[model samples]
Target: MKKNIIFDLGGVLIDWNPRYFYRSVFNDDARMEDFLSTCCNSEWIVAMDAGLTAKENIARGQKTCPKYARELALYDEGWHHMFGGAIEGTVEILKDLKKAGTPLYALTNWSAEKFPWAKKNFPFLDLFEGIVVSGEEKVIKPNPEIYKRLLARYNLKAEDCVFIDDNAANVEAARALGMAGIRFTSPARLKEELSALDNRPSHK
Candidate 1:
């Protein structure tokens, strides 16, 4: 039986960081950090990833912190500028896996509205046999339902998949469901981990 390798898009295959784009908006690093932590935090962004539209997200942010309305607006307007591009080394590994006939799929926590932009900007995303976007499903990672949805929708078995994610909680969730899970640190390390898996009898 061939093993399926599931990948996380942001932080693993793609470089995505709000700070990358926000640095130019806020001159002071400390102030930017404060604004990001207080006004446009991860918790708020996760709501967007879970299916909230950019317009709604911006409106909510504005309501929460009207003083940072300009910054909140930029989150929607300059959203494409947030991506730093593909992690080339990890992309190389993905290509090698494809060349070797391994099945590839992606499970990403991304806004449905924003994902089209990423799909347009990143060519490698086309390589996946299938992808499950959280925003499209109205569920995010670390949630068992989303993972189960991916497996069920694709007719894939948990035991036959190896899930890779940058978040420890997400990785653990995959493991909990009986799939091999890897907590990605760097591309080089990811390559090493996958290589080790390739040598295993189950993967063969």
Candidate 2:
């Protein structure tokens, strides 16, 4: 049987980096990096991905670093600027998978409030048969529950799916759940991996 393919949205299909937009805000690269690393870091962003509302996230940031309250607010205020654009290479792969009649689903650790902007900007997201947003589900990846939720929601067997993610931790989590996991380094590598899997027997 053909394995169902699941994709992660940010960093994989989309070039999402806060630095892309923060450079303009801070003007100085060093300062921008410091602000991002200290105040609005990945840990804080993950909280938002785990279903914290924009308002709450911003407030939490402001409370943590009162000095950068104004800058912290910009996270939600200028959220749309964060996305650089679609990763055309991965998107091409997705299109190819779709054309080949592969079952496609998205399991993304994305903020519910910001996901709409992404959906509007990236039309390729519409190609997925279904997408499970972490923010919407109140869970985040590298956590087994979110992966289990995706499998259950889609009526998919974990052993019959391939999960692709840019984060190694997320990939490991998927593997732990019995789904073949690919730590996507590049679209070219992913294409090669998928081709290799195509010829191999399914994992028991």
Candidate 3:
């Protein structure tokens, strides 16, 4: 029986709209994408989130794109925009699930630096039974290790847990680990998926 629900922070719960920086105010997706493609995918920041070097990452992000540093300045600004509050129906769905006595958890590949801002701004996420952020562990999701750790913490069997993430690679990773997963697209679709799960009454 499924007793736990895990969620992805960005895109799934919070809306990650990168387009917010450009179309609304600045014309910078092209620049940001270029920077992300080059230096943003560093393991050092990953290590920072895993609770490694706190000061190192701040310096690294600063140092990574020294030549095109202004692009980095907008990194925080861009993320703030992409991350809107929780999806409209998500808060209500979480409230309903909580009331129904369901066990809910959050598993996100978040940055130690950025998520604090998110937590400060969004409290709905504070309701999870547990939150596993990659930045804290220096290990991101879809990395089988992180999933395994979450399973162990919840004392859950893969079949008895369903994960929802905004990224396809994340969803695939969950399935690869023998768990059920849904790739979240919209609040309505997520609602439908959750509602469908409620109707089925899983047992395993």
Superpose all Cα atoms of candidate 2 onto the true structure and report the RMSD in Å to 1 decimal.
1.3
Model 2, 89-148: lDDT tens digits are: 999999999999999999999889888888888999999999999999998998999999
Better of 2 and 3 by TM-score: 2
Ranking by lDDT: 1, 2, 3
Q: Which stretches in model 3 have alpha-carbon errors above 4 Å?
A: 22-66, 74-82, 201-204
**Residues 1-204, candidate 1, lDDT per residue (tens digit)?**
679999999999999888988999998899899889999899989999999999998999899899889999999877777888899999999999999899999999999988998988899999999999999999999999999999999999999999999999999999999999999999999989988988976423
Which of the two candidates, 1 or 3, achieves a greater lDDT against the reference?
1
Give the per-residue lDDT of model 3 (tens digit) for 1-204.
Answer: 445888887777777654555345336666656655665554534555566544555466777568655645555556566555567677777777788888899898777777788888888877888888887777887789999988898787887788998889989999998877889888789889877876885455
Compared with the true structure, all predictions reach lDDT values of 0.93, 0.91, 0.73
| TM agreement with the true structure for every prediction | 0.96, 0.96, 0.78
- TM-score result, candidate 1: 0.96
Q: Name the 10 consecutive residues with the lowest summed lDDT in model 3.
A: 17-26
User: Which regions of candidate 1 fall more than 4 Å away from where they truly are?
Assistant: 201-204
Single out the weakest 10-residue window by summed lDDT for candidate 1.
195-204
Query: Which pairs of residues have clashing backbones in candidate 2?
Result: none
